[model samples]
Every structure is written in C-alpha cells, then in structure tokens.
Target: MGDIQAYLASKYMSGAKADAILSRSEAGRPKKKKRRIDQAVPVAVGDGTGLLIADEDSLGNGWGQAEPEEEDTDVPVVTAAAKTLRLKKSNWSLPSASSSTQPEPAAEEPPAESSTATATSAPPVKKRKGGLLTAAQLKEEAEALAIEEARKEAEREQERLEARRRRRAEGIEDDEDLANDDDDDVDDHPDHQRTVYRDRSGKIVDAQAERAEQIKAEAEDRARQAAKKDWNKGLVQRNQREVEAQRERQVASTSFARSANDRDMNDELRNEVRREDPAAAFLTQRKKKGPQRPKYTGPAPPPNRFGIPPGFRWDGVDRSTGYEAKLFQKINERSRKAKEAYQWSTEEM
Candidate 1:
C-alpha cells in the first residue's frame, strides 16, 4: 500500500483512478521494482529536530553566486606598457568608452550601368552652373568638351590645309604668309608714294598708285598667258543666220531697183521696205487705243495660256485634247468594278 501510495502520489494520480486501474488488472501482473524508502520519497521528519547545516558561502565546489557567462563583445583591449628591455614590447591603455564611437554602415552604391545611363539621360551642360554636381556628370561633360574641341580644331586645320592645297593646285605659291613680304618691303620705300619719275604726258609714273597699276598689269599679263589657248583655225564654217540676213538685205535693196509699176502697185509694200509699218492702208491691225476694261476695279483674274486681256475667261471644257474620250473609258472601268469592293485587276485578276 505504501508503494502504491508512493507511485500514485509521484504520478499525481487520484485514488479513484488508481483503484479503477487496479480493479481492471489481473492478479498475474508483474511485481513492482523495489526502491529504498529514503531514495523513493521523503517521509515525515521529527518535529523541531532539524539537522545542523553549514553556511552556504563556506561550502566547497559550487558555493556562492554563480558568475554570469561573459558576453562575446570581442572588443580589442590594451594592456599596461611592459619594460622595453623585454622581447614583448610596450602595451598601451585601453581607449575610454566615451572616446569609442559606433561605426556606421557604409552606403550602397548604384550600379556602374545606372550611373552611366543617368549621365547620358541628362542634357549636356556647357558651364557647370551654380549647382552641386556628380563625378559622373563632370566626367561625361569633360569628355564631350574634349571631343568637341578636338573636332572644331580639326575642322579649322582642315580648312587651312584645303586653302594651301587649292593654292598649290592652282599653280601658285602655297606660302601665302610670305606672298605679301615682297610688297611690304617695297611699299615701305620713302619715295614709293612720291612721284619719282615722269612720262611724256605728265603722268605720275613713280607714285604708289602707278606702281600698283604696273603690278596689276603684270598680274593681268601673267593671267593672260595662263589663259592663252592654242587655237589653230582650220575649218571655214559658214553661218546660216548671217548668210540669210545678207540675202534679206540684198532683197530689200533690190526692191528699189525694181520697175515703178511693182513699187507703186501697193503703197504699203513700198513703204514697208523703207522701215515703216505699211499695213495702215487697208487692214485695221492696231486696236482703237483706249483702256479696254477701264482699269480693273478688283483683283485681276489669273492669266490664260493665250495672250488675251486679263478679263477673258474661257469655258471649263478643254476640247483640244481627247479628254472626253478618256472620260468614257474611265466610266466603263468604274462600271465594270462597281459590283466589287475594289478593282480585282489590281489584285487577283
């Protein structure tokens, strides 16, 4: 019963549950494992007769308060300085807590591609205007400026080179700088501007103006030599226009030598050979001269192909070309295609 009470109490089981379990069990149940009463459970001790106990602090091996586990801060430390004579060198004092600052995390940088994209997306800045700038922006701008400057400088050099090349191609001195050197020295002569000689017609020949004219004449002579062509005229080509004009002149003169009957037969033909408009006798060729439409009041109409006056408007029909015939052709074509949404001749047909 004591063993049963020990087991039941140890398990914190009620008496009714134990009794029911025991009642359901058969008599052939295995024997319980034996344990000493002192080892199994505590029984009642004597009243007010407690055993003597030592001071907890005076006990060995796990006596006082347990030292807390040291946290793993892993901070570096400095020991006191050792003597220089020793192989292990001097040590320094640890830094003060106030002096130590918590290190901040470094900021993450954007990708290289993103930086370049931003630089390209931004418009080119000629001058770094009053604004904060990024390194990428400055770098791109500097590169653009370098390329632009190099291109401009190359263009100027190319122009200069082309000028020199053209001078050489035209058979002239390419060194244009020295071209005026000869004139510079000569023009500086004291008497270059003064009259130094006189010709027979009292012309100021030695003056700078005369010298300039001489130089210009010499240049013209050189140009004339350069322009000289080797024309060996071999063919005698008769001009039809000139021969016809000569024949017309002879015919006009021959009219005067004709018999008087021929000349006096028509007053108009007789006067026409002598530089006169001789049609005034019969044909009223000239108009009765006056403003035809009394100076148009409004804007003039568009001019026609014929030289008729501005007020004349023609009918819309152009009977000259076969436009009416083509209209019938187009009408037949439209009738043929009217049944279809579009002309199949341009497609499957």
Candidate 2:
C-alpha cells in the first residue's frame, strides 16, 4: 500500500499510467460497500428522455437487467441511464468485467428515527408531487365542502327555531325580523332535486299533498280559537255570580253580631261600632220618643271587693249611677264614725 502510494506520488508518472494504477486499486480495494436497497431507493425513470448516464453496469444494484418483453428495449436502457445520472454522486461499485458473479440489490431501509433499522444512516429520500392541489380532486372536494357548509347552516336555522319556541314559552318576546326569517329555498327543497327513489312525478304529488295538509291545519286552528272564546264567556258569568253571593253572606253575618252586642248592653263596644258607622241603627242606642233623662232607682250597693274607693260609676246605664253614689256615702259615714270613736277611747285612756 505504501509502495503504491509512493509510486502514485512520483513526478515521473504519466496520467494514463496513474489512471490504470488507480483503477486497479479500486478493483483490489474491495468493492465499495454495495448500495443496499435498504439504502438505495428505486424510482421509475422516463425513457428516451435524453437523460445522462455513467456505464451499463455501474448502477450499485443489478439494475441494468432487461425484462422479457423486447419491444421496448430502449425503456430499460434509458431508465437505467437516468437512474445512474440521478445517483452517480453516491459512491457506487461495479463488478470487474472478467468476474462471473452479478451483484444483488440489497433491501432499502428508511431513516433511523422513524424506522426500525439503519440508525445513523443516510436519511430516506422522498419524491415530490407536481403541484399543491390536483385538478379533478380539488373540484370534487370543493363541491363536498360546499354541501357540508349548507347542511351546517340548515342545522343552525333549526336550532334557532327551537330556541325561539323555548323563549316564547318563558314569556320573552323575540325581535320580529330575526325570529321570522324565512328558510332559504335550498332548505325547503333539500332532497327534492336528488330524486334517489322517486321519479319526477312522485315529487310533485308529495308536494301538493303536503300543502293541502298545511291548509287543513290552519282551518282547524281557527275553529278551535272560536270555540275557546265562547267557552270563556260562560266562565266569566259564573265567576261573577260567585263573587256577589260571597258579599251578601258577609253583610248578614255583620247584622247578627251587632244584635248580640246590643243585648249585652256593652256601651263602650257599641260606641266603637258606632264610630265605624255613626248614623247606623245597629250602632246607636234606641230611644222611645221621650224628652226627659231617665232617673236612677236601685238596691243598696254590694261591697267593693278590692278597695277601689267606692264611687266607681258604671258609665253607660243611667239607672246604676245613683247606686254607686249611695255606696260611696255609706263608706264615708262609717269612716267618720270610726274616727270619732277612736278619739273618745284615747281621751278616756
């Protein structure tokens, strides 16, 4: 190896001799590690494309072999040429001309982190598609998205109607223009144009029948409202009769209570009732059409139970006034006699 290096470095060597020696070294130096399919990627190439090349057998793998079909021999040759041009920078190995063994393409491996093999190896190459969006597919997807958007809009409108019903039940008034927005024609005619099951005639028949049913419902609602109004009028008269009967009962009970109070001779109680209605016969005392005040005549008074200084006149009955006065006179006369008796007894002692 050192001798070869020294000879190669000699100033006297010709370029041809140097090249021959270098080629021999390449042959003897052991085949550059065969490009494994695990490393070397396969790609279909364009034929007759004027693509460049290196050599027939130089492609790191057994890539030059032609298929059985002979009509397009140029296809494989040109494809091999293009592949060689694309990957020539990679250190490729070729078999010596005299060698009988053909090299086999090894299995290609993907990049390490995203693969199960080939750690620290070269990253995998990816082919690029021509444009961002393909023509036909974009059109199809755009149509689908437009249909999906329409469906979502219809769902939103249905939700709005249901929300309005809930608000009305809660007694909240919704704005008229917003709440009454009409459904679009597309919403009304959603599947009518699709006609998956029915022929054109069935669609027209169904539409007419649906409209007739709607008219019938409106007529029924009008009849119901008229009947409800008549029933309500009868209910109003019945309620009024009940209210009048209750008032009459209240007046009769008041008269009975006033008569009871008069029989008890509760003058203060009578005055309070008269104050409520000063001119009512039920409250005022009855008179026998006389011009004189009545005189008092009663038995001697019963003794006062709790020493309430005797002349306690009962306010309402005029006849009881003299009885109270006589009782007080007796109490004072007895008191004067007891005082005189006490003085006479003391003088004697």
Give the best candidate by lDDT.
Answer: 2
Give each prediction's root-mean-square deviation over alpha carbons: 35.8, 28.1
Predictions in order: lDDT: 0.57, 0.58
Compared with the true structure, what per-residue lDDT tens digits does model 1 show for residues 112-170?
A: 99889887553554876578889998898898888777767988989977887787788
Candidate 2: segments with Cα more than 4 A from true spot: 1-132, 176-349
Model 1 weakest 10-residue run by lDDT: 35-44
Clashing pairs in 2: 37-106, 37-107, 37-108, 38-107, 38-108, 38-109
- How many pairs of residues collide in model 1? 0
Looking at model 1, the pairs that clash are: none
